[model samples]
Target: MLFNSYTFLVLFLPLTLVVFQLLRRGNQRMAMGWLVAMSLLYYGWWNPDPSKPWTPFYLILICTSCMINFWIGRFLAAHTFTPKGRLILGLGLTANLGVLFYYKYIGLFERTMEALTLGKFSIPDVVLPLGLSFFTFQKIAFLVDAYRGKTSKYNFLDFLLFVTFFPQLIAGPIVHHNEIMPQIQRTVSPSRRSVDLSVGISLFAMGLFKKVVIADNLAMVANPLFGAVAAAGGRDLTMLEAWAAAISYSLQLYFDFSGYSDMAIGAARMFGIKLPVNFHSPYKATSIVDFWRRWHITLSRFLRDYVYFSLGGNRKGPILRYSNLLITMLLGGLWHGAGWTYILWGGMHGLFLCVNHAWFALRKKLSIPALPKPLAIFLTFVVVVAAWVPFRAGAFELAANGSAQEALRATKSILASMFGLNGFEGWPNAAASEVKFSWAMRAMSCVLIVWLMPNSQQVMRRYFPSIGLRGLLAKTSMPGPRRFWQWRPTWQWTVFTVILVMGSIYEFDKVSEFIYFQF
Candidate 1:
């Protein structure tokens, strides 16, 4: 169920909270078990139909996956990583990845091989299970940590709750076992439930406003422009249209995802659990490296620790490190979808990161002065928005059934217009004055918000136990007294939050799924 939906807001959330609060007073295990059942129900709540037959298997698949991985983690923890342990770890990795491959990549693999060999085999498109990418990574992290003997004393129930915790389960901040398990163990105490509730409500209200009011509205501007370009052949979009479309989608994605992160964190907070900060005003980042650091913070952590570090990380020299960076990003891109456009997106970022690192290396040697922070932030945002063309194209292709060539062509067309390679003579290109005014205002408004605003984490920064990656503690919260706008248990803030919720509710009839759900 979408966190934005009325059913979730009106029914599911309050009911769960009430039950959890009541059960917390009694047995803690029952409270945890209740959540597990509800989360499973939440995942299975999306109805299976003739079109997507695989939807029915989502529940069974997740449970089986949890069962298998939980035991493997236990096995890895109980043994040493010598002869048999290494072998089991390998098999464990293979088993998890194999299921991922079968559902997420097999169709793309088949189609690619068929095209290469001039074969005519028809490949059915695979609708990957919801939360598969996220939970798989979390599970893999668990297994690897277990192998290193970092994880211990985890029972199946605690492990299961960690994996299927509904708020972050579908599209995640990708919670780690270490980050969330202790919180699960302590849910029985309602000691801070009131504080958590207010914080949760504030976060949810702001996020809901972001998703329904901002992101969905921006999608109206973006979707049509991209759709026109992705038609059976393509359309010639003017420079104004192209850049506006790209930036609109980028902003849409930002609010859609970060908004989701805020709501997820908020909902979890209602249960007195603090999820790690995932999106912390990433567009505010001044470099590609910084962008990754802020955007999808957990996924970056996963790739860095598991993928890059495993490949020898920066412990290696420059050449191998750069190559490893590219490889990791390519894999990261592919993890988003089984599409060449996604791969291209990854390749572009990989190249960007390599260049970014190379520039840092040169600066260190030559003692070059850094660009002013504002300029760096602007340039970084431009590059990031340019990269989003391919990502937006690939996301559209998931529904368009468009070929890789078409996706590439569409991406190139947009990028060309964005860069002034395409014609700009007929700017706004016959759009009505009001239509143009509305569109420009909406897109530019989002741009200003991205550049100027404090994020959800910052607004709620007064709260403790909030997790931020290294160097981001200050970013997550200011050092001094609570800012006037910072969230607190106050009457004024309650009214402000109500206004935000009201604005969100006005758009409730137009509820839409979040953009990241496709991942």
Candidate 2:
């Protein structure tokens, strides 16, 4: 169920929070089990109709995958650093990836074949199970960690809770074994509950405000803008229309996905289970490499640790390093969806990163000074926004025929317009008041907020999550999140939260799913 939905807001969240907290007073195990049951219910809530064939199968699939991987983790931990351990880890990885491929990529493969043979072949579509990509990554991380002797003793319940925790289950702050497992064992005290509840409510309200009031409104602008471009065969769009469409969707996605991350982290916080910070102020990044560090941070960490390191990372020289970066990005893009647009988006970022790295290397060799931070940030933002053209096309491909070539065409057309190939048409002509509360106004507001205001993490940094970027934040030259308003348990702040939450709730009639749920 969407965290922004009425069912979740009115019934699920409060009810689960109260019951879980109450259960923890007497029986911690029952509380954990209750959490697991509630999480399963939340995951299955999408398919409430019993007649749906994949409903039961999806649940059984997740449970079976969990059970199998849990055992594999245990066995691998038992035999860590042995040849047998490596074999077990390899087998576990293959099984997990094979299942992922079946559910996620087979459709892409089939489409590629159809395009190749000009419709001489076809295959039935595969409906992906909810939480498959996220949970599968967590499971894979667990097995790999066990092989490295990085996992401590873990019971099946702990493993299951780690896999199925409802908050981060749907999308992610793609968590790891060490990050979440130990925290699951703690009992929430009343003092802890009060503070955590305050912080959680604050975060959830901010995220809901972002998603409902901001992102959804932006989607109203972006969706039609792109849909119109696709319908027109990407030929007639003006520069204004193209950039509007592109920037609108980019900000829409940022708020949509990052808002979901905040809700996830916030909800988990209510129960005293902290999730990692998934987004920093990514738009503020001065370089592509820096941007990746801030955006979908957990996923970036996963790719670096598991994928890049496995590919020999930078150890094999610059060529191999660049190759690994490209491969990693292509896979990362594919991870976003089963579409070529997404792959192209990843490839663009990979190329950008390679260029970024090569420039830094040359700067060191030539004693060239770095670009000013503002200039660097502007250039990086433009590059990232351009790359998003392809990614946004995949969303449009839903209305178009979910074809890779169609997505490619949509991307090309939008980009052509953005770059003035379609000719530059100036901004829409409207009086300032007339355009008030319009997409232009909303877009400018979003840009200001992203570029100027402190993020949710900054406001709530007083209460850090269970595990996150604290250590890394300390190491970086960047200023910490302390520069923003802090969240405190004051009645004035309570009133502030109520206003935001009530404002967020006012738009409940238009609740939409978080963008990342599809992945």
Candidate 3:
């Protein structure tokens, strides 16, 4: 179920919270077990056809995978550093990866084979389980950590909860076993319940506003242009239309994914569990390296520790290190989808990262001065925005069933339009004319918010900002204290939150799924 839906807000969450709180007072294990059951229900709630009964099959798949991984972890922990242990680890990795490959990549493989052999082969459809990529990566990390003797002993119940913990289960900050298990153990305590509830509600409210208000609205501006481009079979676009499409999607994706992360973090907080921060004002980053550090922070961590390190990391020479970086990103991109566009997107970022590291090394050697912060940030943002075209195109291909060549053509057309290599005229359409100025204003407004605003975490850290009449009453004359946009728990804050919640509820009738759900 969508976190934005009425079914979740009005029914599921409230009931779960009440029962969990009450059960915690009596039997802690019962409370944990109740959460596990509800989480599984939540995961399986979105079966498209009730008559077909697909969700139960998926539930069994998830449970069986969990059981197998648990045994694998135990085996790895038992055998430690023996050759037998390494073989076990390799086999376990192969098993998990084999499942991921069959479900996610087999269709792509079949298509490639058909293209090469002129339609000599066919394959049945494989239904990819939701969150398969995320949970598989998390489990692999757990198994490896167990082998390395870095993980503590975890029971099956705790392990199940860790893998299927609803909030981060679908799209994740990709929590580590060591990070989450202790928090699960502490959920029975009532000590910080009130504080958790208040903060959690506020965070959830902020995320809701971002998703329904900002991201969804931006999608309205973005989706049509891209759809038109694809329908035209990758025809060239006008300059104005191309820029509009690119900028609109760039803003749309940021708010959509970041908003989801905030909601996940906030929901977990309500239960007195803390998920790691996933986004941190990434657009403000001054370099590609810096942007990766902020954007999808956990995924970057996962690739670094698991994929890059396993490939010898920087422990090898410079050439091998760069090769490792490229290989890791290429796989990372493929992890997002089974498409060539995704591979190109990943390859572009890989190239950017290599260039960034090379530049850093050159600067150190020559004692070169750094570029101005504004220039650096602007350059980085432009490169990031440009890369989003391929990422967006790949996603469009997945939705529209367009081929890789079509995606490439569409990407080329859009890039040409963006750079004015195509005609500089605007696309003449009623929809485009009606919303052009408004869309521009909205895009600018989003840009301003990203560049100037302190993030949710910052506001949460200091609930009271000294602004308006309140600033005059402050004892200190500090400049930072006199800033605007402090998020207090006053009536003003209450009214602001109420408006956001009401607006989000009004939009909830449609109940759009999060963009990250596909990943």
Candidate 4:
């Protein structure tokens, strides 16, 4: 269920939180049992209708994969150097990855073949399971770590909890074995600080607000731009509309995905389990390499350890290391989806990173500043935003919409419509002011929210009160009150949460799935 949905916010969350907290009063094991049961229910809730609950079959497939790897982890931990251990690990990886390939990529492979062979062949349909790629990678990483003696054998329950922890389960920061397993063992109760509850709820509300009020509104502009291009049949976009569409989509993706991440992190925190922060202010990055460090950080770590290192990483010569980097990122893109576009996306990033590294090396060698840091930051933002057009668009043609060719035609049509020079005439008197006024008010409210609210990182540090950049900023800025942002934490959070909930409800009709869920 979506965190922003009424049922999740009003029904599932409150009930689960009460029951889980009550169980935690006894012991960590009891609390974990409650959590496991609740998490399963949450995962399976949509699939229980008996008509089309095939989604849970996917969950079952994942659970089975986890169980197999959990056992493999145990066995490999005990016999790391033996041939049997190598065989077990290799076979486990093959089975897991083979399943992933069959489900996720076979259709694409078949389509490519059919295109090449003039529809002479067709591939059988495979149901891609929810979060299969994520869970599969996590489990494989576990086995590899065990084989390399980086982690100990974990009990089935702990392993299961790590795999299916509902907060990061659907779309993840992709929790690691080393980062979360110990925390699961030592369950802690959330303190009944009015401040804590207020902060948690507020962060969740802020996330909902971001998704509904900001991203959804932007999608109106973004979707139409792509749609218009598609309608025109492979049209080029004008510079203004291209940049506008690109910027809108880039911001939409940030707020939408990061907003969901905040809700997940906030909900987990209400139960006193601190999830690692997933996003920094990545838009503020000055370079491509810096951007990766700040964006999808857990995935970066996973790719570095599992994919990059597995390909000999930097251990061989520099040329081999560069080859490994390119290959790893190419695979990483494919991991995002079963499409050539995703492959291109990943390849572009890999190429960008290599060039970035080379440029940095040259800068160090010559001791020259090619551009000011601020200019570099601006250019980086533009490049990243442009890259997102492909990432957000359904197809390549969609990304090329609103070009100069289209804009020229659009201008002719618009002028013809305006002057009654074509089939169009006078404006309709039926266009009501109330509808427009309501929309204007709503738009203003969203703008006010963006101006007043802090980003996800800031919200996280506020609730948990951490010591990173967020914490440091809060510490230094706490005593002052800006014109509109002046309020005590308790009142500020309570009021903000209420408004966010109300805004989400108002925009419920346009509610969309979390963007990252597709990945």
Candidate 5:
């Protein structure tokens, strides 16, 4: 069920919280068992056709990975890694990645081959289970840590809970077993501070509003623009349309994924567990490196430790290290989707990272003044927005709005339809409506977006500027002892919460499934 939905907000969450707290007073094991059961039930609550049961797929995936890793941990703890042991570790990783590849990309591979070979070859169909990418990484990390003898053999129950802890289970900050398994052993109870609950609920309510109100509405505009471009036989778009499509997509993707992360983090907090913050105002980043550091921080950590570091990391010479960085990002991109577009998306970032690193080294050698932080931020944002065009578009050619050859044909159609030059009748061209800027609200809407949205740094500077000499005097100049009222007025919070809830409700019906659900 969607975290933004009323059913989840009013029914599942309230019932589970009450039961968990009440049962916490009794057997802690029973309380946990009850929670695990509820989590499973909530996961499957929306399923109507039993023929395609989701929970079993998840259960089988989690159970197999956990059991195998638990054994691997025990084996490693008792024995050292010989050549044979290393081979076994390799096989384990392959099995994990193999499952991911088959389900996620085998179809795309087959389709591409068929297109290349004139339909001579195709792979059999396979169903990708929900959370395949996420859970697979969780298992790979578990097994690798085990092989390195980092963790002990955990009990099956605790291990299972770590894998399927409903909050971050699907789209994750990808919680580590090291962080969460210990939390399970702790006393699970409501925090003594009412503020904790209030903060959690408030954050969750904000996320719900972001998803239901803003992101979903934005998608209505974004979806059509890209689809129209593809339908027009991949033609060069005017700069206005190109930027509109690209920026709309960038906003849609950011709010959608980050909104899901916030809800996940907030939901876990209701149970007194703090998931890592996945987004730290990524749009504020001044470089591609900075962007990765802020966005999906946990996944960045995973790739660095498991993939980049495993490939000899910076321990190798400069050339090899750069190669490792590129390879890691390329694979990282492929992890997002089954298509070649995703591969290119990953490769582009890898290329950017490589260039970014080289530029840093050159700058250090020449002792160049750092780009003005504001200018760097602007450039980084532009680069990222350009990258999103590829990520959002159907194919590489589609991203460039078709090649020059295809643009010629598209131009003919555009001219034919525009002035009735080719006797083409009925069904006006989409390009026609697009040219009439006065008829479209898209331009005004774009301006609204730029004005309303500020990066986290901007927000911080505006509301909580530094205690510099000028600022310290400003605070000291207050007539009376400053009250909390000056900073955080109760009426403001109440009004904000009311508006958040109202926005969430108004768009309640369009609580589109979390974008990360596909992963």
Candidate 6:
């Protein structure tokens, strides 16, 4: 269920929180069991739907995958560092990836065959389980860590809770066993409860406002334009239309995914568990490499530690380093979806990183000065924005026929329009008026906020969920020169929160799934 949905916000969350807190007073294990049961219910809520009978199959699939990985992790932990252990780890990895590839890539493979043979074959419809990509990666990481003796022995219950904790289960900051299990074991206290509730609600409200008020609204502006371009087979787009569509989507995805991350982190915080920070004002990054460090911070860590390092990383010299980067990103893109557009998107980023590294080396050789911060940020933003065309276009294609060539055509068309290779015949005046100027203004406002505003972490720097506030005023005060925004329990903050809540509530009738939900 969506965190923004009425049933979840009003019923599921409140009821679960109250019961969990009450249960914790007497039996911690019971409280933990309550959470596990609630999480499973949350994950399986959509099952048994009339329209999608196959939905329930996902529950079975996820449970089976979890059980398999749990045993694999235990086995690795037992045998640690032995040749036999390495073989077992390799087999476990293969098993996990084999499941992923069959479900995720089978459709893509079928489509490729059809394209090659001129419709001589038909592709079967494959319904990918929600969050399969995310949870699978988390388990793979666990197995690897167990093999390297990086993870301690964990009980099945703890492992289940770690993987199925509702907040980060579907989409994740990709929690590590070491990072989360200790927090799960901590005893709940009144002070801790109060602090978690306060901080969690604050972060959730901010994220809710971003998703409902900003991102969903921007989707109206973006979806149609991109859909039209794709429908026309990437034929025509005016300069204004192309820029508007691209920029709108760039901001739309940022707020959508970032909002989801905040909600996930906030939800975990409410239970006195802290998920890793996934986004860190990535638009402010000065380079592609820097952008990756900030955006999807956890995924970057996963790719670097597991994929890049395993492939020799930079240890083998610049040539191998660049090759590893390309390989990692190519896989990373495919992990996002089963399309060539994603592959290209990944390849582009890999190319950018390689060039970035090469430039850094050259700068050191000739003692060249760094670009001004503002200029660097602007250039990086532009490059990132351009790269998003393929990502967004790929989504459109994947939703339709899962054809790689179709995705490439859409990407090319959008890029052509974006670069003004298409003629300057702007959107018809009526079509332009239909969208109205307010959307452009909203998009600009979002850009301004990302560029200038302090993030949630900055606003609540001194208010970790476990630690009680230092002092109301002191904790709410600006912590740094760059942090102009702060959160206080003052009248202004109250009104602000209320307005955001009400605005979000007012739009409940049109509740939309988050963009990342498909992945």
> All candidates' TM-scores?
0.96, 0.94, 0.93, 0.83, 0.82, 0.93
Between prediction 3 and prediction 5, the one with superior lDDT is 3
Residue 332 lDDT, candidate 3, scale 0-100: 85
Writing each residue's lDDT as its tens digit, candidate 1 over 1-519 gives 899988899999999989988887888899899999898888988764547554557798899999999998999898857677788999999999999999988877876988799887776766688888999999999999998899968889999999999999999989899989988886533547888888888888888999999999898888888877888756767777787888898999999998898899888888888899888788999999999989999999999999999999988799999999999999999998889999999999999999999999999999999999999999999999999999988965555466787788899999998888887634454542213646855685789888887777777776752566335865443555768877788889889999999999998878998877877
Q: Candidate 5, 394: how far from true, in Å?
A: 4.4
- Best candidate per lDDT, number? 1
The digit string of per-residue lDDT tens for model 6 on 354-427 reads: 99999999999999999999999999998998999999988866875545666677778778887878866656
lDDT of 2 at 354: 95
Candidate 4, run of 10 with poorest lDDT: 426-435
Better of 5 and 6 by TM-score: 6
> What lDDT, from 0 to 1, does candidate 2 have?
0.84
Query: What is candidate 2's lDDT per residue for 1-519, written digit by digit as tens?
Result: 789988998999999999998998899999999999999888877773558553566778888999999999889989989999989899999999999999988877877887788885556667788878998999999999988889999888888899999999989979987878888887766898888888898888889999999899888877776776666443445677677777888899899987898889889989888888899989999999999989999999999999999999999999999999999999999999888888889999999999999999999999999999989888888888899888888865544256666777888888988898878886645541122235655684677789888788877766774366575467743334444267777788899999999999899889898989889
Which segments of candidate 1 are over 4 A away from where they belong?
A: 48-56, 123-125, 187-189, 431-437, 469-471, 475-478
Error of 1 at 518 (Å): 0.5
**lDDT per residue (tens digit) for residues 433-489 in model 5:** 433443234532643443346422222222221112133235344334544433232
Model 2 Cα shift for residue 22 (angstroms):
0.8
Show the colliding residue pairs in model 6.
Answer: none
List candidate 5 stretches off by more than 4 Å. 45-58, 80-85, 116-119, 188-195, 232-235, 394-431, 434-495
lDDT of 6 at 400: 59
- What does the lDDT read for residue 198 in candidate 1? 81
Which clashing pairs does model 3 show? none
Candidate 2 Cα outliers beyond 4 Å, as residue runs: 48-54, 232-235, 398-400, 428-438, 475-484
Give the deviation of candidate 4 from the true structure as CA RMSD.
6.7
RMSD list, candidates in order: 2.1, 2.8, 4.7, 6.7, 7.1, 3.5
